[model samples]
Target: MTDEELAISVSGLRKSYRDNQAVAGVDLAVRRGEVFALLGPNGAGKTTTVEILEGFRQRDGGDVSVLGVDPAKAGADWRKRIGIVLQGTGEFDELKVGEVVRHFARFYPNASDPAEVIERVGLSDKANSRTHTLSGGQKRRLDVALGIVNRPELLFLDEPTTGFDPAARREFWDLIRQLSHQGTTILLTTHYLDEAEALADRVGVINRGAMVAVSTPAELGGRHQATARVGWREDGQARFEQTDHPTDAVRRLSERFGGEVPELTVTRPTLEDIYLEMLGEKEEQQ
Candidate 1:
């Protein structure tokens, strides 16, 4: 896509601490108004790369652009267009939720209503409660509230749902959808493969400071083209086979059984399965 279609652009990104290369020649692009997930195991260069994109850390060498400006040199005006929710709680001890949100809103010129933002993050009930009294998931919601109070064009989320329970996670997903509907671009980093599959339009996997792959969650690592495993019970035994045409295989089995195939199952690789396979292959190459 063209530059106008992209919210973030990077090429040959590199960062190092002494002899340890935290990010080694990474390249990434995020399209405008899309939810993109960056996935990797701990110690991978994902954090370094994201920090560089967010302009929180300097890069050793690379061309980096975020929202049409190099983040390294971006001023306050540019920062106003970008929002970031880091990996943990936004600890504002002793302050009530409403007070914290109102304080942050003052930092942005075009801030959203503090009360609306607090309610949007499902913290209206906790608005009067002190920050230190909030639960882990509630704290995360507060972090998100602060991040988006500016009504930023691009939002960066690092493990935004880390402490959330299952229901809370689904709620957060719906909130993300609402933000995307408002034309906000989001870059998310998470260890939860299922969350990535559900929320990301595309996912990029990183390993050993390099990109393993970048594609839509369904098509990543050719997962959409991978063969399906068809299994069935037969003559007091179990049989299974991998086939590109699972429907044809099932039809043949049905004919042999002269009716519905007993205990039949057709399975394809899940996003987690594909992610693990890609990581494993990358390790073998290293």
Candidate 2:
């Protein structure tokens, strides 16, 4: 699919179980070949929303389309073009890593080469190892390898790096970047704000089953243009001020000091900071 086309679209999506609403009137659109991140605290309905799009669950009310076909009415061919890496690990513990990936590759009409897939996910060295013997990070890589074995045009990654260490997370991010470069549309949900900032082209924040905001990481909650906090040492104590124009503040400070301002620092809100503030506002509103 071309980058301009929408891979998935949802409008007025609502799901309720008896008296509790899991998803409440949500609208989302994912562009082809883009890495879109859905961020929110637990119980924010992110899982439910993704399930609806994946055709695994029924929605109470909404118009949902995936790859130009309504997910609720999608056929086998429609399903073939998508891949899902769920929160849970795979269950082929007894099989070798290559055996597991090769087995899944058969399910798709046109699958990637098993060896190539393993190498792509950085599992080449462990390709002969048994799945049960792999470490947590290795197991997660096995999951990813299986997910893309089908060569799906769209992929869903739900907390794929949950058990990964810092080094492993960085390596996984590189793998994701390679997939995106190949024009694979991805929908990612993760608790790591830094991951979203590093990988996503755009981010959508959902809270209490509702989307609070959608924008680039820098622009979310107007963070890119938000007031900057300037701090410096003065009279043996730290003094700080917030202003929209930090350049002017720095210039003034420099003039006052006739040189560098001691311990000077200018900071803007980070993605996590804005995200937490948005969640706090949502709580206050309720």
Candidate 3:
């Protein structure tokens, strides 16, 4: 894609704190109108890299552009074009949900209607409730509401569903898809592999302060080429083998059992499995 087509671009990015290097010669690009998921282990420079992109921290070296402007030198107008939902919830104990959303809506020039934003995030029922009285998942919805209240071109979501239950998480996923469908570019950081698999057009994995790999969820770490595990019960004991052709193995097992294979199953590596392998966590096992 052309430079003008990208919402964010980083080349040879570097950052360090005292004696520790948080980011080292990293590179990344996020296209406009795309959901890009960034995954990494603890202390893998994810936060530092994001802070630099958000203009909350200065970088030591690199050419970084967000919305065609250098974030290191970004101004108030530039900041207004991007929205961020941090990991922590806001402390608005005395304020109603609608009041809080309306207050934040004032910060941007092209802000959306507070009521509509609330409804979009599935927070319409809590619009009149006190912020402190909302449940954990509701608070997260409010956070998303505030983030989109600006009608931002690019939205940054950091651990957006940390406290959500399974059902709530699915609901939030739908909300994210709705936003993306509305032409909003999103940069998502999450520990949930399933969330990344569901929401991201492409995912980038960072390890040891550097980018290790970037690809579609299905192809990362060669997951599509990886072997599948075929398992079945044999003599009251489970037997398994890794094979590229699991269907043939299953057919063989079915014939041997005269119509059915007891406890027969075939499974492939999940996104998390490939992610861990890419990060070299699986190497420790070897």
The residue pairs found clashing in candidate 1 are none
lDDT (0-100) at residue 132 of candidate 2? 93
- Candidate 2 — which residues are off by over 4 angstroms? 1-4
lDDT of 3 at 195: 98
Per-residue lDDT tens digits for candidate 1, residues 43-146, read: 89988889888888988998999999998888899989999999878899999999999999999999999999999999999999999999888899899999
In model 3, the runs with Cα more than 4 Å from the true position are 281-286
lDDT of predicted model 1: 0.93
C-alpha-based local distance difference test score of model 2: 0.92
> How well does candidate 2 match the true structure, expressed as C-alpha RMSD?
1.8
Ranking, lDDT, top scorer first: 1, 2, 3
Q: In candidate 3, which residue pairs clash?
A: none
Model number with the top lDDT: 1
